[model samples]
Target: MHIISGHHHISMLSKDAKLNNHFYQQVLGLRRVKKTVNQDDPSMYHLFFGDMSGNAGTELTFFEMPNIGSTVRGSNAITQIGLLVPSYESLVYWKERFERLAVKHGEITTYAGRDALHFEDQEGLRMVLQNNNGEKVPDTWQAWTGSDVDPRHLILGMGTIEITVRHLNRLANTLTELFGYVEAYHSDNEAIYQSVDGQSFGEILIKQDLGPREKPGKGSIHHLAIRAKNEEELRYWEEAVKERGFYTSGIVDRFYFKSLYFRESNGILFEIATDGPGFTTDSSIDELGKDLSLPPFLEGRRSEIEKNLLPID
Candidate 1:
């Protein structure tokens, strides 16, 4: 099996573009790396945020709707997003910062032997600042100098995400058998899986839940993307998934990356995307996200798209 390195990016839904932009860019200090429209829904804005270079593992994207309702939490939903910080001291710095900024956060706690600071964004997306296990590659991150957040303390990249499922066996088997993920740890209710390559970005925790189902709305994850090296690998994954009786939305060209999407046995949406032709493919890196960008197909309708999108500032 061709192994998935880690996360390419994770996309979520947000109701308010300005608030989402302010929270991610100004509050969390991530750089607004790309400003584009949702390919599937050209009228809606798609925003990308990440570290300075907007590398694969650091990306967090959003679909701006302005009026979407809140997500209902239950099975089949991505529950939390984990951001990796360098050390225990980094957690301390965030604790003080979250308090001063009045950001809602929970007490720092240790899970699976590492410390974490749990918090929520303005849209109530659950997030955590967690310490890495010293296995991450240093190249996975580039410094973000966009805000007062010290380069040393800025989020390194996306470390992991938590997903809730009714049963763990099927999803766990798919991850380990097909995706080359290994069971790092497990309990009756939760299990942690890590990529065999030891990359931190796509690590995931699957919580076994037998309660109510989750509803999708604003602040909910639309899909989690795992990294594929190229177009060939993406197609390979699609074939593999189809053979296993899973329905995959065969290779999609998103301009930045090619994608293949499918839901796991438990119904959580997952996407496999390539790592190249990134945000700088159109706009220069230095001027990324400064202007609204669209795919060539959508460029013809730029005037119509812009008129409908809410102004960012």
Candidate 2:
């Protein structure tokens, strides 16, 4: 059986491209790693933020669609995203930084025996900064040279994601049997799953959604991507999912990574993505995110795309 390593990236929707850029780049101190257009909707900007190099597990991306309304929070939606910092002291530093910036945040709290700081972005997208306590901490992606935050406390990568699901058993079985996730912890209404390979990036906390179904819009998670080692592994999953009667998008080339999208029984969008041909494929690492880039097929429309996109600070 083939299993994914962990999360490749998490994509969300945002209303204002400028505000989104400022929050992730300036406030969060993440590097603007890629500037491109959404593959399906070329009119909207698809922005990526991460550690200096935009490593696979570090990415938090967004689609800029100003016309979409805010998301309605309920069942069957990703509720929160977590980023990992180095230590408990780093959590303290962030609490003070959040205060100084007037960002709405909560006092440091403990969850699953790990220290966490809960906060929201300017768009009310819920996020958490947690201390690294997993079995194995993946390599820290380089910090941005111009970041305001200290390098010691910079976010390492994606930590965990929390989502609501109506069919917990089915989702849990698929995670364990098909994706190789192990049940790390469980309570009455919630359960945590971690990759069995001991990778630290793709942990998920799923809670029962006993309420109404969620409405997707801006500020909602668009899709969660899991990492495949390469094209062979990606095709393995595509075949596995298709055989199981799950509808898959069937290996779509994302330029950065090949992707296969399928929504599970709970209606949460999941993507299987390859880890190679990364953000630096077209642009050198030193020049990434400085210019608008398009896939070779879309290069003909570069002029139109440039005119449509708003400037990023």
Candidate 3:
């Protein structure tokens, strides 16, 4: 059985919460599904952007670190994030939209035989809009009607995340042996692995780079989270990771989903999160991301958390 379902979410660092929210919501046309604080560090904002419903595979989250420095790009890091759009035509729509909005982006190009548009957020967070023309997967992401972008051109979900590491064999072995990811494609220095039936959203592209370790700050990808079907599956992974002699964070309840965190041998953090008890656990769909939502453990300090967070409007 495939333990890792797909890309649950990719979390990054942002120096400015307001601009980050604006670029993602107004520019990229994603919905702010959740507004909360980082449980590990509640002073900083933990903002989540995804489809209207905030499905498991659609999330692109950020932790607002106002004083963080710029990211010094190098190896041993998640190099880029991939967002899936409906078709190749959607790339044209986004290209024109980015030009009009003055957002920096590259021309539509092919990556791994799929049409992709490379772009960067205001903070220089790297991302690619990949074409999901005929992938056989459930249509679970609900389109946000409020977005100015047409529903047909709306981003479907998260796609293959690009991770660059020095010791490719060690990381690749961990993924295939520990997580049950199968090698779908491979070149000399690059390899693609899929968790579920070679689905695009379930893929991870690994690039072997011998550069220095990345100095993470603003615009740096913090972690890549893969999906676990439920709490039971989450526990199984936690034990599985521990038994393999790797240190783990164990099963941590994030209120919405339980999570297990561990850094692979390459020093890249990976999170296994449950799919159940979603964002609606505290607020309804309509009310999602409108107000700050905290887990039960942090509810007592709501006032303090709210006061620290800068307004994102």
Candidate 4:
């Protein structure tokens, strides 16, 4: 059986944490759900933005890299993020809001049969706001009423993530055969796949490109994480990936959830992360992202870590 649920989160690189926070939280209306440091590099900040309460499928995270260079556009990398808006009318609402706020965005267009508005963040992180057309699937995402945008038009969660790769068959096989994603649509060089559950939150769009490998930098997506039900499912995926001759990170304790990382043949990093204990494990829902949080292993060094990082505010 396919253990993957939907997107757990997508992590990217950012040059300035404060500006990134403002663009996503104030301008885009996502809530800052966590303030923490990169698990591997404690000196840098890791921020998570999502629906209110930081549900699994809604998270968009970033690792602050103050000196990072510009991303070199190319293939074999995550190219764009897709966020879900409630309806086509919501797209119009966002378009006007983007103009009033001076946010860079394109005209509304159809993508995989859904109306979409493409936009870029301050650091040039590309994203599309796709109208979900009011899909009635059950979800955990909560609208942050504190946001400037109306709750009805608030971004519900992440949708289709676009990945550009040279070897389409190899990556497609990994997604379909390994991860159990089923192809839902295809045209020209692009194809859309959805998880077994067929939710909009679980879709992926693959673009075939024979260009050079992407040089990741500020605004470049680091990895796409899919949901695993729990630690047991995470372990199952680790062995499955390893048995398939792929290198796996094994089960990793991420505090909020367990995770396992592996790079598919096309060089795109994929992470299988658990759904809980979610962001609320450490901080209460009301107090999330108010202060820096550290896992138990890093708690002892919190002072030193905080000293090296700039405050998001």
Task: State TM-scores per candidate.
Answer: 0.96, 0.96, 0.98, 0.98
lDDT of 2: 0.86
Reference-based TM-score, model 1: 0.96
lDDT of each: 0.86, 0.86, 0.90, 0.89
Residue-by-residue lDDT tens digits, candidate 2, 1-313: 5666778899999999889999998888999999899988889999999978788889999999989997888898888998988889999999999999999999999754579999999888999998985346555456565688987788888888888888777788888878889888888888889874444477888888789988877788888998898999998899888887899988999898899999888888999899888988998888999888899889999988888888876
Which 10 consecutive residues of model 1 have the lowest summed lDDT? 132-141
Query: Model 4: per-residue lDDT, tens digit, 240-262?
Result: 89988899887888898889999
Error of 4 at 184 (Å): 0.7
What number of clashing residue pairs does each candidate have, in the order they appear? 1, 0, 0, 0
Q: Write the per-residue lDDT of candidate 1 for residues 161-250, one digit (tens) a residue.
A: 888889888889999888889888888888889874455566888888898888888888888999899999998999999988899888
Between the candidate structures 1 and 4, which one is better when assessed by TM-score?
4
**Backbone clashes in model 1, listed as residue pairs:** 15-66
Q: Where in model 2 is the C-alpha error above 4 Å? A: 133-135, 197-199
